[model samples]
Target: MGGTNCPTCGTQLMDGGKIAGRRDPGAQDVSICRGCAEILVLTRSAQGLTLRPTSATEYLELPEDAQSLLRVAHLLVRRQQRLVRAPRQLH
Candidate 1:
C-alpha cells in the first residue's frame, strides 16, 4: 500500500487488501501478480526494503513493512553470529 506500483513488475497493485505474507520470519513475503514471480528475496535495510531477484542484476525497493522485517532479520543474524563466537563458560 506504500507504492503505487508493484516493485517487481511496475504493475498497479490493488489499493486495499492483504498484499504480502507475514509467516516467513526473516524474509518479507510478497504476492506478485501473475507475471512477475521471478523475484525471490525482499530485504529491509537502512535505506529501505530492497527486492532482489535470484538471477537478475536489478533490485526493487520495498515498502515499510518489508523494511522492518529485513531489519529484524539483520539483527537476528548478527545476534546468532555473536552467540556462535562468544566463549562458553563451564562450572
Candidate 2:
C-alpha cells in the first residue's frame, strides 16, 4: 500500500497516506487527489474498486450547504485529534 498511487491525483503515496471517506484504515483507503485537492471516492463491487472521476467532479460542485457538512466534520475530527494530543491537567 505504501507504493500505492492516489486514485484521484495519481500521486504515489510514499508512506501509506490515508484518504477520507475510507471505510478501512489503510488496507483499503480513499485518498484526497493532490491533482484536484479534493476527496476521491472509488467504486466498489465484485470487480473491485475503481476511481470514477465524474463522480468526484460532481461532488466538488455540490452546493455550499452540502459542502458545509463536510467542513464541520473535518473540523470536529481535527479538534478531537488535538484533544488526544494534549491531556487536561487535573487541579
Candidate 3:
C-alpha cells in the first residue's frame, strides 16, 4: 500500500507501512475515507488500486462483527479529526 485518494472526499491517504498482524489490502477490502469518514472499498484496475464508495447493501452484507469494528473505527477517525480541528487553549 503506497497511496490512494478517497473517492468521496478526495483526501489523499498514504500508507506508511504494513501494520502488525495485518495483510496487504486486496480487491474488495473495505476502507474508511479519512477526509469525509465515508466507507470505501478497494477496486483494482490496470492503473492501480483505488477506492470507491461502498453501497448501503454492500455494507449491510458484512458480518455483524465486521460491522461493529467498522463503526468503532469510524468513530475513532471522527474523534481524531475533531481533536485536530479543535482550537488550542493557552494557559
Per-residue lDDT over 1-91 for candidate 3, one digit per residue giving the tens place of the 0 to 100 score: 3437776566776546421112477655777766666777776667767677777788888888877777777777777777455321111
TM-score of 1: 0.32
Error of 1 at 23 (Å): 7.0
Q: What's the residue-level lDDT of 42 in candidate 2?
A: 49
Tell me the TM-score of each prediction against the true structure: 0.32, 0.35, 0.70
lDDT string for model 2 (9-35, tens) is 465533343334454443333344443
Say which prediction, candidate 1 or candidate 2, comes out ahead on TM-score: 2
User: Tens digits of per-residue lDDT for model 1 on 1-91?
Assistant: 3442456556544335423332332445433322333333545556544443333222225655744554455355445545344321111
Best by lDDT: 3
lDDT of 2 at 40: 45
Pick by TM-score: 1 or 3, better one? 3
Model 2 residue runs over 4 Å out of place are: 1-4, 12-21, 25-31, 34-36, 54-57, 60-66, 69-91
Candidate 1 regions with alpha-carbon error over 4 angstroms? 1-8, 12-19, 23-34, 56-91
* Top TM-score model: 3
User: What C-alpha lDDT does candidate 2 achieve relative to the native structure?
Assistant: 0.45
Clashing residue pairs, backbone N/CA/C < 3 A, model 2: none
Residue pairs whose backbone atoms clash in candidate 1: none
